[model samples]
Target: MSGPIHPPLCRVDQIMEVMQAAFDPAWGEAWNRRQIEDSLAMPNVFVLLVDSSGDLVNADAGASGLAAGFVLARHAPGEEELLLIAVRPEFRRRGIGEALIRQLAQDARARGAERIFLEMRENNPASSLYHKVGFEPIGRRKAYYLFADGTRMDAITFGLSI
Candidate 1:
């Protein structure tokens, strides 16, 4: 007898689609295809992709739905660092980001992570979302992110004890 089908996990191409739609070019926060590919190849790296309903997707298989957002993170000895996260612009303010973070925390804890950390530009509006998710500002790097136009932004690091 056949078992019930499960939606396929998020893939790099789907993540690239969301990244292309979600990130503004001026911020330069999105990763290139090669970077994502390389990161996924690492054993300690993980990714979660979700649709509008906050479910995993595989468009090619016509299961669930197209990917609406994704979170990529890396695990260390006792910590997990949220490396990247993005949701399609049209899907913003709909709790997709929060879903990703919550899911990431669950997965990280499973991997033995005791703390979760992330760094973002000071001007990024997503800080509020991180705060809402229980992350607190822990540190900062002055003039850390240099834009192509010669502008610089401070990077604020947030941490949460999982």
Candidate 2:
């Protein structure tokens, strides 16, 4: 972690590894490998972050600059949706999430997008990070996220003008 973490563009499997570390099975928020493969197959969809720092690396991990945190997004005619964004458990609060958010905004702007939107569980603590990056709460869906433990959380939608 010497320099600024500029998550390199990576393949689906590489990104999925990061997703695995970033999400817990109980949360029901992590996307599976096949889902990511299917997503990458679609047009106008792409990944925009991979933590190459090796800060969370172990002897068994490969040298693909594995994802510490990453953003999966889709761009349409004039807007984009941040489908998912996550930072590995050990990598959280180290500026990786913030950097990814900043980069996603730049990427959207590059596509001539008017703005970017994202939705997350209302109980997600990262809401502060979203707000700090200039995202405004635009809407909410009641009990949008259901967990295996029988609890449901509202989905808070946020928007950031590009």
Candidate 3:
């Protein structure tokens, strides 16, 4: 927590752990190891985060040696999509998420992407974080997310011109 938060090139195992913690099955589709492995294998996909010393933080603090935050993204031929950004619940409001966003935007720009986009549930708490990092809601998809209870939620698509 003392050192500056910076994005580290994360391994597949680390990415899976963070994704599991961030996206529970009840909340949404839980990404399995194979899925993560495939994502890591993709030429355009990247999984990265700020390492808290030797530990990997996801978005909250529960495990030792890792902070609680991560950023998953994919850069296609001309655009980039921020697939996921998660900080452990305990680590919220500590600027870790913001740092991750900034890093992703920089990466996107470096990849020659003119625009970056992300989709989140309209009611997601991290929407403000996206806004703070220069993302603006440009579109919406009705009933884009489904809860375990069979209810649906709207997906707000945010975009930033890089």
Q: lDDT for every model? A: 0.82, 0.75, 0.70
Q: Candidates' TM-scores?
A: 0.89, 0.83, 0.80
Best by TM-score: 1
Off by over 4 Å in 3: 1-9, 53-64
User: Residue-wise lDDT of candidate 1 within 15-99, one digit each (tens)?
Assistant: 8999999999878888999898888877778777788877756444655436788888988999999999899988989998998
lDDT of 3 by residue, 9-75 (tens): 3455555566666665667755677766677677778765655432334433432355467777888
After superposing candidate 2, which stretches have Cα over 4 Å from the reference?
A: 1-9, 52-65
Best by lDDT: 1
Give the lDDT of residue 7 in candidate 3: 29
- Better candidate number, 2 or 3, judged by lDDT: 2
Which scores greater on TM-score, model 2 or model 3?
2
Prediction RMSDs, each to the true structure: 4.3, 5.1, 5.4
